[model samples]
Target chain A: MDARSLSIDGLPVPFDDGQTIMDASLAAGIFIPHLCHHPQFTPQGSCKLCTVRANGRYVSACTMPASEGMEVESNTPELNDKRRTMLQMLFVEGNHFCPSCEKSGDCLLQALAYELEMLGPHFPQFYPDRPVDASHPDVLLDFNRCILCELCVRASRDVDGKSVFALSGRGIGKHLIVNAESGRLADTDFSLADKAAHVCPVGVIIAKRRGFAVPIGQRRFDGEPISRRVDWLARRRADDEEEQ
Target chain B: MSNSEPSVRPATRRCLATTSLAGCFGCHMALLDIDERLFELIERVDIDRSPLTDIKRCGRCDIGLVEGGICNAENVHVLREFRRQCKLLVAVGACAINGGLPAQRNHLDLGQCLQEVYLTGPGIVHGQVPDDPELPLPLDKVHPVHEVVRVDYFIPGCPPSGDALWKFITDLLDGRTPRLGHPLLHFD
Candidate 1:
């Protein structure tokens, strides 16, 4: 297999011929924070979080395919500030009650905020009236807590063969919705075992009865700051696995 | 469902073909990431027409694994083709089984969003909208594969966990009916 040489932040790197810029960056030990583009999933490019300067323009590192002589910059104060804005956009768009949620310690969205030094959501909270759906008897749907990452949507639609979950609105006012016929989760053929349930990056889609089962600090992603290699790798792995 | 039923005989090693419509490939990649089983899968099931394979379509296959929701015209056509050729059609991720996250955007008006993105938004290259034949046409709504075509099995996960994927494939190979037991295997 032929490997193409590319430059990221002026550093020369070799990328597999067909690899995406994100893959090349990860393989070369450069971590670009992203919420939606998981390694296991196809690059959606929906979340603008992973936006990086490729050549001269800002392009999503996850979706931009690696090519010969490509110039990439994973980090810069400007990029970091832009990403911080994106993180704030995510926080304000929906409910992200970090203090009360179980995924607080290990949540990627929360960690990204911390890394970018986002003290508070600068934008006014959209605060849509999303109801908590606990009817399934297995998984919980606290729409308020959802980031609308579409991981669940992709999981159900792409991975699980069940197009049960979807993001309903467009632009800044989007929300994840149930199927067409029933409009309620229980009405659809969806069950607790679907990929959509696991795809939620926030506490929005919680397991029905398992909210407090695991202590907050002991959660898989808690305690350890995301800056360390092991934790960083785990976050990267989880980002790739977020679809699950 | 009890696990008391004895295991069944395995079939001849064959190929697995997969396609994804409006979705990310996380679940599919997670399927491959079942590291231990992955080696055995490479040895046993020949992967064809997969995203990794670079082959979009193939002549024949034992299993057709579909990921993503059927959102557009192309998706419907692809789903029908997969239903047509494969012996068993498996909805391998949340999207195929339940319409997943991309379906969330389905609740909004397609025309309005198109207008926002292509006409009035910040990144529009062409300011004036063209009503010519060359312009991309929008679909009415996004639907799941099972709605359009019959699906034989469902693998559930955000991206289905490695253990679940391995079990699903091995069960299919061994002629056992895959059970949609847990929500993690089947909701969101």
Candidate 2:
């Protein structure tokens, strides 16, 4: 009875102390359309995909602390329009060819684009020069598809205790870098078993030798929308946290 | 609104022109994938200039469905002509909207690509990059249809599914703005 509650899009959801708006919402099965947030990681609020209006002000749901009597708006026409713009920017800023990428159906970026009804990559494509590193026998690093979500950075540093990934440079020059001096996944002790390897939300981090294991039509977000998969993903992440 | 003029009440069937520029005709295949529904469609719209109809050029038409990215001088010329002939131009697929797979070479120099594929590539015996006068001059970069001509609508799939095209066609014929929502709105 002492638990405080906030309403997201007018849904009264109760939250225990210390939970962010995102934490309480996801725990209550409300998806905020975030890519940077992981259930177990300390939410860095880097991606800005979780932007929401808290008490009539725009703020990141993952970083904003839940407060009593706080009215938040997560799903609205204006908010979705802004989020759609973000997705479009994400699409154009990198070389994301969903038709060829192995992660097309399973890609969170592509699934979210479909859920939000993104018609095209609205902005001019950067077509940035990127490298494909296949040095690791078990993994492939295709930087062309990175969205700068930093999920792998978090999982590596916090969970695997490897600190193998970090964001380098500044401004548009900012990019993901391998921690090893040799600048390769194989140079570092990055096994396929690491949580970092499983954390990429796009095609950037791919497993080697196992392409199209599941057919595209049957893969994640192919039969159903990402909105429907949020609960299952949330539950899985929660289970992982409990195990830890 | 048809009067008793009878000679011509806009000819009933709206003329539709479709074309592929730098694409593999996969979008056209999707159009054909309309399958038996093609009969219902044929009754409504008349095919004007298309590879399917084997017409050389389209005259004034009602709607134009353009597929593929603009990658050469000929593509630009054809697209401009299509714009002049059609009242409403719809970019029909991922290539037409965002240059799709063909745009992957945007980062590399055109000269470099030609050099690698022809002159310097392995197992080549005196291979030379063709500069034939008959060939269309390549543009420096591939661009979406909207980048070249004003696109009235955009359908974003690698090649949109048959159901998606059918929905768009039915909506256009029914006087509703065509929208591919939810499951139909896909990029790959």
Candidate 3:
């Protein structure tokens, strides 16, 4: 693993041969905020939260490969402001009731909104009608909280090999759907052990009976900002696996 | 809510007004949550036209902290009235900023919702939709305060913590604009 070096926000960052810019910067403890790029899954640069400037052009850091001598500018005032607006847009696009959400403290969307200092949604709320699916015995699927990140889709297809989740529609109409023809999670082979069950960044995929097991103020992201360390998802998986 | 750079004003004892519209009044509770610090705040500012004073009408105010979303004609009237009287208006909670939980009804048909609740629901012998003339007409959808008027600050939490409100109000009274820090800057 020869560590190839590049500069992010004028600081030197190193990467492996095939590592994307996000992998390199985050591995070096430089935070480029992202929602869709899970370390375990293939990079889907759909969220655009990790957009950074290489030389002079804007590129998604999670998908763009790191090249030596690349001058990457990730955290500028302009970029952060745009990120805040994007966070705002995500809020209004979905019905995110943070107070009532069981996933409030640990949610990446909520945490990122906090890290970005998002004041309000900054636009009129979409308030689309989304159905909650409690069809599975151990899992609960509340579609209202989804941000369309597709981390669950990637996890189910690539890691769990069940392909239990898939996204349907186009643009604002785009939404998450179950793999079953009946459009129900109970009809599919989805299980509590599947990675898809654990990958939702919002309150969409909550485990039954595990609500508020770790109380608010003591939960993850409550004590630390998202940029505090790079391995929250990995730590969360490790913790869940340990319990199992 | 404390994103923009705050311009300094003359350090006079600022007059503060507060109101709740289409909200649970939890934010006002959080404001009292400042606990003993309320006394300190009272010393620094003049309170007026709020629930704490029971004043129905607003006068000229230096700052107004608005809690909750706009859900009815009365809420609209109160919001505009506050805006006209207050120099700087702050959207003080999740409902006030983003239409929080009350806005959940936006996706549903309002008439159907009322019918289900009042007319056709269980345990109703001869129920009818209330058509009192004194009642304010409900808006078609819940709207955040900013949609109706210009909001100078946005502090986004279900009910923003007492500490957060204290920090914001103190800063405003001191003629400084504040930026809420992390953890304390929570949305939930």
Candidate 4:
């Protein structure tokens, strides 16, 4: 299975043929921060947080394919600083009320911010005046908390076949959108069963009556940071792949 | 190919290829969540162009499972590709079937969205809005994938449970028209 070999951050690593740089790094136990790149999904180079220096050039670790004898630097000070800055930008761009969010303890963005020691967001907060649609009986849509990651949009469109969610605007001001004619979720055919609800990595979309189902002390993956989650997933992935 | 000959051959097993649109990989992942059946499914049919496999497009697939809604030009192209390659196109998740969350912006005007973020926000965007023709122009209204292309099957769920997907898949593979009368699968 030794298809190629690469050096990431000075550590020599072996990778299978067609393995992505992120997969190789993760296999070698190197930590690379990312949001949109899930092992379960297509490696979307959407979130640039996982950008790293590969062979002295900046490239996304998620989408870049690994090759023999390639040199990669994943956690250099400059790259970490850039990632931290980008994360902070995301923080200021959205109203991430950690205390009130259902996904607060389990949120990836929040945990990343903490890991980077983001004491306070530096950029001017874009306290966007967006609405919350509780129109559907089963789910809630709070546009204010959205990061425009396109996860929910992709999940709904690809997984659910509902095409219920979307991004309305462009660039920094972009926000998630719903059906046009039916401003309300109930008006359209959105239900409790839509995949869009799960794609929301934040509290932007929540199961209507399902929040707080687990007590604050007993919530799944609570108190654990996102990096830990990634580590756990990476371990699980290795085990799964090994079994395969 | 005999209509009435009592031959003991299994039903023609079909290969289904799936591609996601604007939604999360949740629905496709949910399909894998069937856990044990997932192992069996890979044996039963050929899986092509799925996020699981890095393949982008496939030709002449027996079934096409599409998730998410079409919001941009890329989505439209992908949907058309599936339609062309798949004989029986199935819209798998709520987004593909109904225009899930992104459609919410259809309530507001695109101009208002621009004003709030650029001209009205606290930060100053120094230059005029770049009128990029390549960017998928925000439609006046968001539409589901099926609205653009005719779909043969529909599976609905917030994220449809793996159990539901398995049932539908098994039925379809068995050459039965999977009946989705349950509340979670299809709502009439």
Q: Which candidate leads the pack in DockQ?
A: 2
* TM-score of chain A, every prediction, order shown: 0.88, 0.95, 0.95, 0.86
Return the lDDT, model 3, position B38.
91
TM-score of each: 0.53, 0.93, 0.94, 0.52
Candidate 4 chain B: minimum summed lDDT over ten consecutive residues — where? B179-188
Better structure of 2 and 4 per lDDT: 2
What would the TM-score be for candidate 3 when compared with the true structure? 0.94
- Could you give candidate 1's per-residue lDDT for residues B3-57 as a string of tens digits? 6879664457788888878779887788768887778887778888878788978
Give the best candidate by TM-score.
3
Stretches of candidate 3 off by over 4 Å are A1-3, A233-244, B1-11
lDDT of 4 by residue, A1-244 (tens): 5457899889888999889989987777777887776665567798798999998899999999999999999777899899989987786566555545666545667556655544334454454457788877888787767767777777777777888877776776576778658667778777666656665656787877666666543443444545555566465423432321
Preferred candidate (DockQ higher): 2 or 3: 2
Pick out the ten consecutive residues of candidate 3 chain A with the lowest summed lDDT.
A235-244
- RMSD to the native, candidate 3? 5.6
| Alpha-carbon shift of residue B49 in model 1 (angstroms) | 71
Per-residue lDDT of A160-187 in model 1, one digit per residue for the tens?
Answer: 7988888777776677788857577777
In terms of docking quality, model 1 is incorrect
